[model samples]
Target chain A: MNSSASTKERILTAAEALFAQRGFEGASLRQLTAAAGVNLAAVNYHFGSKDHLVEQVFKRRLDQLNARRLGALKHIAGLQETTLEDVLSAFIRPALDLSHDGGGGLFMRVLARAFAEHDDSLRKFLSENYGHVMRQFTVEFARLLPGLSKEELYWRIDLVTGALTHAMSGFGIIQRKSDVSETSHREQTAEHLIRFAAAGLRAP
Target chain B: MNSSASTKERILTAAEALFAQRGFEGASLRQLTAAAGVNLAAVNYHFGSKDHLVEQVFKRRLDQLNARRLGALKHIAGLQETTLEDVLSAFIRPALDLSHDGGGGLFMRVLARAFAEHDDSLRKFLSENYGHVMRQFTVEFARLLPGLSKEELYWRIDLVTGALTHAMSGFGIIQRKSDVSETSHREQTAEHLIRFAAAGLRAP
Candidate 1:
């Protein structure tokens, strides 16, 4: 990578950790710059402003996460034999994989903070950029659960999203045991989430 | 009410709003006291320090919320006739009701922040102070399901909690129509959560 590109990558990496640890508001520019080993000019040169940097932090992970989710959904979206669990796995496995990947779990913590932040600009940015990914998943979910009204489907999906977000944020009690391999632990986590989400989505 | 008592209430109310609007770390003491229309000394006199103030903020709401949860759980915990839905209702309705109650929803937002914050001291405080409520509910949930192993049961409960916390934090897309009464909306929310959670916990 070029020097400029590596500089940008360093800032993004440090920003992700600081933001996850100290929140968007709490993480100061000075601290972020110091952590990244970059100067103020470097940040300004790259991302223009802290707000824009935050957006990039989200875009970096979410773009990949949602793309994988959409890629998975395409295979079974409207298939007659696709079970609810299949649709759920497509939606969930990517997130679980992301969380287990190096530093991806920290990104999930940042995402959770964004949800809690309730910042209007961030919300709008997410909705505008990634809303279609969710809409596509909703369509697949609708195909499998023909009994639910649109409102009901939205409610269930929102709840499932909440559960997944919470779990991915790593705040819950279910920790991976030291004895378990990373891949094994990820698979176990996926199974638990998929089963629970599938049943929740199918609830009468 | 007495002057000191009302002062404390004012601080808590303001703290909840500021914490929700910004965050635990983002909301400064100056802002908190200013919003409360009080001085630094008053906060010090009333709560000693910001950390204690945060604890009091949680204690004020959690005490009432968990009391109601336990009260509801007591009515139908282990009875053979109690359906999974009943146990789920006992656990969920109180939270939904709390979220609709005055300023309680803001507290949920704060709770979400705490989860995201992942502060060790705060986590310990919550576990030590209110852990019993969750334990009681878990016992009842185990009795009702009887099929899930302890580890599996804990995993599912954690997911259900994540979903409920996410929904109650008011970040999800689900919104009440203007025509709907607050009570009606809350009832609808409770129904959706209990049904989803019941099915989730009962998943094979």
Candidate 2:
């Protein structure tokens, strides 16, 4: 990466980590600049303001994440008969993959904090930017479960999203000990979640 | 109510509202005291610290809520063959009823924020103090679905909790315009959530 591009990425990485650690209200610009090893002016020059900086951190991951979700959905739609498992995979695999990506786990943590805290501006930004991705899933889900009312479909989708988000945040009550490999645990988690979610979606 | 008892209740009520609005990190002791119409010392006197205060706020409603959940579960267990509907109602009714309770919605919002925003202290507090209630539900859930493995049961329960928490937080994407009556909308939401959750649970 070029010097300027590298600096910008560093700032974002630092900002996301600090924000996830201390939250938007608790994180200071000075701390962010210090962690990024960049001058304070760089943050202003690149992101304009702290609020804008926070927004960028989310958008960086969310934009790509949503695209992957949409792509997965589209691929599933093209199949002759999209079973419940296909639909579940499309909705879930991107999120699970993101969790394993470098720094992607931090991004998921940030997203969870934003959603859980209902930080107003962040929530609005997400709705405006990523709401359509969710809507697309909702439409697909409605089709998958033709018997469900629109209201019922929305409710289940809401739950599914919440569960996925929670799992992504890595805050499950059950934690594996140090002896367990992280990769294996994540794989097991993914399999269990997909199966459990599929059963929920296919329930009569 | 006694003066001290009333004061404690007032602080909790105020804390829940501020916490819901500004989140655990965002809402300060000063803000909490001001909202409660009490002095700073009252907070220290009543709850020892902010972390303790947050735990107390949750404890206040959680005991009653869990009682209701266990009560519902007990009713369901009395039947030889429990339907998906029965299992779902046992799980969801307490949460929905809490949401409908006067000022209960605010508490739900606060609880949602707490889970979304990860502070190690709060997480530890919840796991220590409130984890047993979750375990209680999990035990009942295991009995209902004897066919699933231990890992599978936990995953579904985790998702179910996540979805229910998200719904309670009022982050539902489908916003009802001013044209819809609030009562009608709430009823609609509860009915839809119960049905969706029930269907998902029943799916093989």
The model with the greatest TM-score is 1
Listed in order, each prediction's TM-score against the native is 0.95, 0.88
List residue ranges in candidate 2 displaced over 4 A: A174-187, B75-84, B174-191
* Model 1 interface DockQ: 0.84
DockQ of each: 0.84, 0.54
What local lDDT score does residue A189 receive in model 2, on the 0 to 100 scale? 73
Sorted into a CAPRI-style docking class, model 1 comes out as: high
| lDDT for predicted candidate 2 compared with the true structure | 0.79
Compose the digit string of candidate 1's lDDT tens values, residues B1-204: 598899999999999889888888778989999999988688888999889999999998999889998988877754658887887888888888777687777888888888888778999988877799999888888887888899999999999999999998898998899999988998999899988998888887
| TM-score of candidate 1 chain B vs. the reference | 0.95
**Per-residue alpha-carbon lDDT of model 2 for B138-159, expressed as tens digits?**
7777777788778667767777
Clashes of 1: 0
Candidate 2 C-alpha error for residue B27, in Å: 1.6
Per-residue alpha-carbon lDDT of model 1 for A44-73, expressed as tens digits?
889999899999999989988988988888
Q: Which interface RMSD values do the candidates have, in the order shown?
A: 0.8, 2.2
Clashing pairs in 1: none
Candidate with top DockQ is 1
